[model samples]
Target: MWVPAKFRSKVLAEPVRRPQLIEHSSDKNKNKNLETRPQQHPILSAQQHSISQELHGKKPAVFKMPVDYSKWDALELSDDSDVEVHPNVDKRSFIRAKQNQIHQQRFERKNKIETYKYERVVNDGLLKRINALLAALESHSADADKRSPDELMFMAIMETAGDSPNEAPPPPPAGVHTQEKEQPTYSKMMAALVDQVKAKVDEDKPENRFAAYVEDVKSHKAKVEDLQRQLLEELDSLEKEEGRKITSENIHTGFDSSHVTKGKAEDKSTGEAKKSTQKAQTVEVLNPQALGKPLLTKKSDGQQSSGADADADEPMGGDDDDEDEVEASELGKKFASIKAGDYRTCLEFISQHPEVVAEKETDGLLVLAFNSAIDGAYELARQCVHQALLLQYCRALGRDGVRMFFKRITTPGHQAQKVFFDDVNSTFARIKSRAKEIEKQRAQEEAEGTGGVEQIQLHAVDPNTTINIQIPPENSSDPAEIKAKELFNAFPPGLQRALESGSLDEVNKVLGKMSVEEAEEIVAQLSEGGMLSVEEQIIDATTEEGQKALKEFEEQEKAAQQEQAAEQAALSKYSDDPE
Candidate 1:
């Protein structure tokens, strides 16, 4: 067969033959003969081998395939590549700029992660410290004599810090060590950090940032506790869900066929009894009167029987009665506990039994506790007011209850009680005076058909009017009046006009729209200006003049009682005479 040119060399080739022996000759002649012989090409030799294979009917020799290493040649080293840069820029500077940009990106990422971690650590430490201080305060453990000076200092700092963010700590308490004294390493580190931050921010040197931080933490305590409670509730719900899943899985997969067989057998044995028991239970649930009645069954003798069942039911009734009696006794004991003037115990009791604040039956006990707290030692009384929980108790007492409580303490009994009553009474007087003034203005406006609206005049004051109407001042020539004038001038023109209208209702409307602190400040100024005064003041019995006044008051009371008795006796005599 004729093969294509591509395969011609392999398909048609000369066959290998044995070399013939040469005759003996001189060395020069042999070398000349060897040189003169023609050389066979490689392609011709390969074709000769293939032809020999075809002729011999033997398989052609297989050659191993060569591996291409050109793919590896495409890879270029990063450093060896030439970079394109602007003609004006040096290659080294361009390379350095690229390196710096990459470095800056990595550095910023590292710094962000590090800062987050640091803040997390700081917040965790702060939370721990706040919880510790709150627990100490709540449990009254900080007052213990055995506590260290550092503990006392820490408590004082946290307690005495003002609500304002820029407020400083009060002076160190007696028996407490100064900041320079030895403290925990953590506290020292925090102090150092606070100092560094203050310095960097150019804050005042006298400000105590650490104390302010503590105060801020304390202010958000309720929110933190609420979050913790929510987290705990969520965790509990998740656990319950998991438990339900496990229970359902077990119900579906854990039981064996033998258990079903046992259940069926038991049902067969107790089916009639179960049906009768269910019927009785249904009757008891449907009929309210049937509650607590023993289930009676008809005996073979045709008589209904419930001998042991009735006996078994008696103890349940007795248990309920006993529980009611025990609860009543416990409530009575709590009420009686406040009669002793122990404010601490009273506060503890109120905390444990908050129902005292809400229950009408405990109103008397609540008042008694408050009176006892006021009558107790000065420090204890102050501490009672400072207790955060006490504010809730006071609010629960309502306005009337609070007024009565203050009235009871207003009596010249204890010096501390009187002092507290005076301060509270003054504030109450200011609020009441403002309320009364607003009411009076509203009444006048209603009478005049103005619908409680004070008409404002936009025109300027007339200087040439025939009637030289002098504006009567609220107070004249008194020191309080001078102070009031100064405060009035300081007010904005609109507010001054409202105040000048002499309709306190308008002033109240304006104040109502203001911030609470500003309103309070205005009210305080009004009070200091003698515009709000207590309608009544109790005489101080500790003074000599008060003692004489008391005797005169007693004589007057005796004379009035005698007159009242004489009138009653005369009326009784007339009635006895049937006239």
Candidate 2:
């Protein structure tokens, strides 16, 4: 019914069924017209129904006319929010509200970041998780694309082509396979094509070109050989450079060897005088060079400090430590206030009197700063407890305790706690940075395959390069004797070598030194080999072997007894017959 004008005549030619025909009459009785055009008439509909039934073998399809487009509805309601909007509200006001909310959120986020301590470590963990999450997200995103409408349609198209391969075959050339199945049959054209192909094939005969091919192959081989030599030279130079870097990095220097010498000299000089009184308590304190050593000393419990005692410690002080009694008293009171967690008051006091924070205490920490940590001067400590008063104070608060103090620090009121925290955190930060640098260096060495080792394992060495594999020069003539001497020196003679000298205590000690894996391996070997063999012998004696031996002995005795009886019977028969 919807056929194009050009196709209408062809469709109308097929008339397989009969339908009621209409007779049209024209004016004046003359033949009007046979030409047909589109008509919304009953006869035309009937003709269309007959054509469908005859051509397609189905009932005529009823086509619906398209509704009118581009027609506007005057009374239609508008859905836009701006039209007939609220009297008081406007777009600008709404935008301002949204902007205010965004600013509030941004402010909150900034405050959160500033307040959260250990943010760096937390961020590192988040970054690691994000990296793994991104990898998974990317894979899922690709899956989503594949499942989308377009990709699914593409897949359907590919599946519809039966026996389709991963890659589509190239289309034949224009002349080749150009004939359609619906095209008119052409026997003469087919014959002409076959004859033409035959003539073309005969005119051009194949020729041998192996000599030219061989020359080309030889040239390529020469180029490849030159490239391989260049690669080898590059590898050698890179290896040499890497070896030098590794050697330089591994070289260690700057050990405080003088400290040991100084300690020995001090011990010799103090051996006599210090013996009379109570021995002083030695405590570890970090020096200016960042060396951890036992340098701090505390007086005995019974000792009473006098003017001379203060004078003894005065030599250790510097020009900055020239504080008179009145100044020391005033500064001490201020330091005590700071120790009491009154940071606001202490900060003001230090501004007027700076020497309170500047002078170094005997504990090696800043005077007021050490008091703040030990005396529980912040919001962190639930209880105030002093572990020690003198040199042992720093010692008892070991490295771990010191770190815990740093972690438990609360609000840094004003500048006092801030300055103190910076001092402590600075030391740990340096160590952490150095550790990261070492880790990066090690990763680089592994990637470049360049690091120092006591020995190198060579799977395959270059024939051109000379390498010395021997570690220690061959010094001994008899290798067996040397190996035996080594084993003897490594471990003392036990039950295996000298059973007489072996003691149970000594053997137990050696066994104690054996690693768990080594012990298990030894036990496993014994159970599988020697222990199993011994157990099998015992089991055989209990079940089969002993029984077999006893059976054989009994069989021999029975055979002897039967032989005797046979001989006696034969003699008796001869005696009775008397022949």
Candidate 3:
């Protein structure tokens, strides 16, 4: 039949699946897109130009448009059903057709393989035997799901031999024994199962899981309720103990009803201890040591207490027995700290409560006096305890605290009492003098700083050492010079020469030969005569005091050296410049 070109054009036109919309902005934009098709990519043009240059050494024409093979292919294969082709579709070729066509050759080559395989199976009777065995196994096969690995394998073997019970395997050739090979089927199946599952039977009880969860929840709730009750009871008891009265009505008033337990809470510390504040009148001080510090303390001096006529013998805080223990401990610490020369801490304690200075110290004089004498801080201890005596004095005693303290020391019946008192007067005088000298030196050092004249280290006031009380020689015929000459004449010839030459070690040796009193009298005479130098303090360099003194001396020497060098440098510079 001959078709009109108009009819053919209408038939070949794209089929209209949807109705057209009225021409709006979007429709106009769609029409504009149909006006022109873009050219092949410019990058492809550049690539072809570069390729041409690389081959022919020059740029060539722009890339020619690639022909669309889709429509052509569809047209060519339209009636050829045998050729599998995509209609009206374009597909890009990733790989070019293989020139050798090995795939088709390989396919044709498998034809002889199948034939040979069939012949081999038939010749060996493998296929027939396998099929017959399979039929027999299927007839007697157990359910696949219930069969174990061994049972299944045994069935397989039985089926292969037609269920022969008495057929035994032939003995292995002399040295060649048969061994079982691994079964890949079990391994693959187990691997698959392992991947899909996790072993968690403890948590995975299938039947009682929900019941266990319910029981656990009930137990937890009970535990929480019990804990809540305990907390509430504790809080109630604590409130009562702390002086906040707990009445029946207000027992659980502060706690939330929702969280409150039905039973009482156990107490912390005492199985429901009440607030300790209830015993407010008891005055429970944790450390009476601190309490004693604020009550009555004294400085280490013979200084009179402000309350000398007051009851200084009795312990403070007498309202309780703990006061006695506390006072003793405080006094003990004070004595130790003072003996150790830790005046800083003693001053701090006084600063906290200055009123402690006028409080009871101790009743016995021998205690403070003996301790002071033994600890090598005789003057300081005596002074402190004397002050304490004044503070601890009873108004009814009708006497000075110091006098009363002395009376206690010199009581006739006890020999030990005399021992403590006998040395007090003599030791006091020397220590007082030495203390004055030390105080003067310390004050001068503080006032002058490092720029002051060299310091004189004072020897400790003891029986063995000499006390240098050098007085300035007045008019060369001074009393000091006369006294020194007399002392010199009195000494042995060896001592006289050693003294004249200022050999301190020789003088010490000479002193050691005489009794302490005789040595002291001679040294005193020499000292009053202005014989000793300022720098000759007996220093054991191995001792801490000696080390400190040596260090100071070294620093002073270095300073002097620096000053001299500076002066020399100034003089040299002046000479060089004439300025």
Candidate 4:
């Protein structure tokens, strides 16, 4: 058998020993035979003497340590005899398949990494261009009209040239083919983008469109950064997996694997320590008073009541020596100490202390809290909870508070404020629609004689005032009384009181609660009943009925003016005749 070059040295290093057979003869004859055997050569006799001394004397032979061949096990040499393949399959094809699989995996990983890098580069360039354009616009806002569009585009290109020094030029127009296009020192793409922005400003004139463009670029940059971060994480995972495979192979290949194992263990421990530290830091940051106490308290009937409800149930202007006075004072102080624009902190404080929401003032604070909750940027489920809590607070504050909230949010400010206000406005409109639906359902129930004796709290004209009326069950024997009661209930409690008091201011205040159609219907009903006197009705020209009413009013005013003039002329003629 032919020995591999790697094992040839080991095979030749050890000599084979053969057992020698001794002839059975008399001792004298054996000595005579040895003497006659031959006069051995001088060097051979010396070597025999040394060997005999090594075997029989106290001298010992040198011991050699065995050579380890385990390191070679990791080597995927083509001459390896231990690799087994299917008897029916070709070995070359099997190896080729494995190579192709490895290549494909590597190609995919590289392509993904390259894609993320490309996206990151593109987003970074876009962000830089937007920042440049925004800076230029803001710096020259006063002289923006004085500066030409071409000059602005040039300035934008110059500002971004340093970052993307080797930016590629724009592709040639269709139908024009060239081997090599002229490379410009500045980016053509950035110039084109600037032109597009200028065109948008001229065409649509969106309020500060460049600033919005900057925000969009930043958002895209953030997405690209996230993708890059994920890509790096995947690369790190791949490196770790490769290291583990190498370490596993090293174990069988007689290589030192202790260092890799130790490093991995140390890294794991460090990660665990970091997690524990982060958890402790997070716990330290949270307020125990805010987090430990539940927002809703369980009632005796197993129903839960929110803090706003509980506060509402308490009598106003209570004694200063109340047991909860100190806590309430502390909460108020905390709320006051919160910085403006810190909506999240304000929201948390309001949630923990619902009494703040029930106060007559603090409409601005409640609006900010509602904005923070329903801003549509946070988690959906958490946002829903926040919205529900704020809506409950709105209910606790009543119609006046809601109106104040709407007015405060509607005041012109940042674009984000407008968006938040619109969302809130839509939310309130939906709530009002829902209330109408409920009212319709209740009316139907009353008509069917299934009305219950429920106590309904109606918000009055005054912000501080609320009227709690008990809805009587439909048990009246007189049909007229029932009809009167139904009519009385048809009008809002505030409107009913306003009509009875005959106060225009009170009527206007109650009318604010009704929609335009409902207010018109109520006004017409009052006029028909002779409860309200109308000299002239103001009409909105935007509506067809209002337009027709306005035309008739104008015609009537013109005819009256002509009649007054004729009377003046007739009086003058009588005075001239001296009658």
RMSD of each: 41.4, 43.4, 44.1, 34.7
Residues 301-364, model 4: lDDT tens digits: 2222222222232211211122221122323434545544455665555545555554432433
Models ranked on lDDT: 4, 1, 3, 2
Tens digit per residue, CA lDDT, model 2, 146-191? 4642243234223333322222223333333345433222223223
Which parts of model 2 have CA positions greater than 4 angstroms off? 1-482, 493-509, 513-579
Per-residue alpha-carbon lDDT of candidate 1 for residues 70-188, written as tens digits (9 for 90 to 100): 75553423233278888999888777777677556545544444443433444455455556555544454435446643454456435533322422223333333343454344454
lDDT of 4 at 71: 63
- lDDT of every model, 2 decimals: 0.46, 0.37, 0.44, 0.50
Worst 10 residues of 4 by lDDT: 317-326
Candidate 4 Cα misplacement greater than 4 A, ranges: 1-88, 107-130, 141-186, 192-210, 216-227, 230-579
Best by lDDT: 4
Alpha carbon lDDT at 439, candidate 1: 66
What TM-score quantifies how close candidate 4 is to the native fold?
A: 0.22
User: TM-score, each model?
Assistant: 0.16, 0.14, 0.15, 0.22
> Rank by TM-score, descending?
4, 1, 3, 2
lDDT of 4: 0.50
Q: Enumerate residue pairs that collide in model 1.
A: none
